[model samples]
Target: MPVRRFYKLYLSPSRKYVKTLKNLLGFVPGNLSLYRLAFRHKSVAQSVKKGVKNSNERLEFLGDAVLGSVVAEVLFKLYPYKDEGFLTELRSKIVNRANLNQLARKLGFEKLIEYDNRMISATRQGSLLGDAFEALVGAVYLDKGYDFTKNFLINHIIKSHIDIHTLEQTETNFKSKLIEWCQRHGKDIIFEHIPNQEGESTKLFTIVVNVDGEVMGLGKEFSKKHAEKLAAEKACEALGI
Candidate 1:
């Protein structure tokens, strides 16, 4: 039996997704439902039945692993002589949330996402795009198999979007840099998150970085991790490190 015909027999409702996915993926997917599910964010997940819930979260988890593996393999082949540390750092740089968010936006995946307007506003949509991109990768892997997805990432994404040379030159680990600076100057580095009393749904964290018993930098962000990074970045600038 033909692949498309076989897919249609099991998933007739996904026929409309075929065209959209073909344009996004550069090839017609064998299983259209996977792609459809990939765009369904948890915030907008509908109960497929009574107990079963459908969302891209599972696909995102799977895709994250698949993407990491593929990227590792690509880096291993691309830099055969580079040590493990160098490769790890490079991989982190490539797959980091900020980089992935930028990549998702660049590929126009943000427009295709199905999310809850109440849960995620337009201004906050940027943070969710990376997860959606990961889910898309998972869907591609499941629908088209590993080799095709690998090629899509390597030939289409890495070749067109990433400039490895520029990435190597960029300094993304501001916290690490600040830590090293503190170590060299014989200073203690500490990060503290201020308590939030706001009753809003989203909690904002204010992080203060202290150096040698003095407050050096302050940063406010939605998450503690980002707040720390922001504080470290400010500290790095303040200390001229």
Candidate 2:
């Protein structure tokens, strides 16, 4: 076994994050800028004043794609005998918001995020964690390269953290739950689809769900399933169903 030497690194919120870079990855970060960028939230537009044009939103986008690709590749190689559908579901379990949020919480990334006072409210707590997690992944990729990113994800995020078996058994299908609730209450739910424009996306949908001919809820999403589900979920809340 190689000798392991411990070194403490100071970070924001007066916290100490142990740096095992020299021991675990054979190098220490020469630039902390990238790490800072990883925890940045777009809500803090002041990064532009500091000459950083883009916020971590772009990084989050890139990280999301990267994470999906890596997770899919790992599942594919690990289960060569499995079918595509199984792989897709497995990938979903691995990359879901809840799973990612759990990872962020476990990593204690809440301390690293830079957010405005408006976003610090209790309701927005989960949003910060999710964004930081994606930003961290993006930061890791930039700082350590693809191989290190892959290994860190598999070793730290996947193998040691996420429990695949429990996730597989858990149901996050809000739409299904909403439908069941409606059925139990003997209420006929109907979703009306209307098209709308959101930025460059030409294809957008607005859903109005009616319960007993009354407009109980409204929602918007990029897909029919998402729109319907959102509307259904809103309806569930409105009716207390």
- Give the TM-scores of the predictions, in the order they appear: 0.67, 0.63
What is each predicted model's overall lDDT from 0 to 1? 0.83, 0.70
Deviation (Å) of 220 in candidate 1: 22
Summing lDDT over every window of 10 consecutive residues in candidate 1, give the lowest-scoring window: 8-17
Q: Candidate 1 at residue 96, lDDT?
A: 77
> For candidate 2, lDDT tens digit of each residue in 93-113?
778665677778777676667
Runs in model 2 lying further than 4 Å from the true structure:
1-30, 47-54, 176-241
- Residue-level lDDT of model 1, residues 75-164, one tens digit each, is 899899999999998998898766888998888887788888888756457758888889989999988789999999998888999987
Rate residue 101 of model 2 by lDDT. Answer: 78
What's model 1's TM-score?
0.67
63 in model 1: Cα distance from truth in Å? 0.3
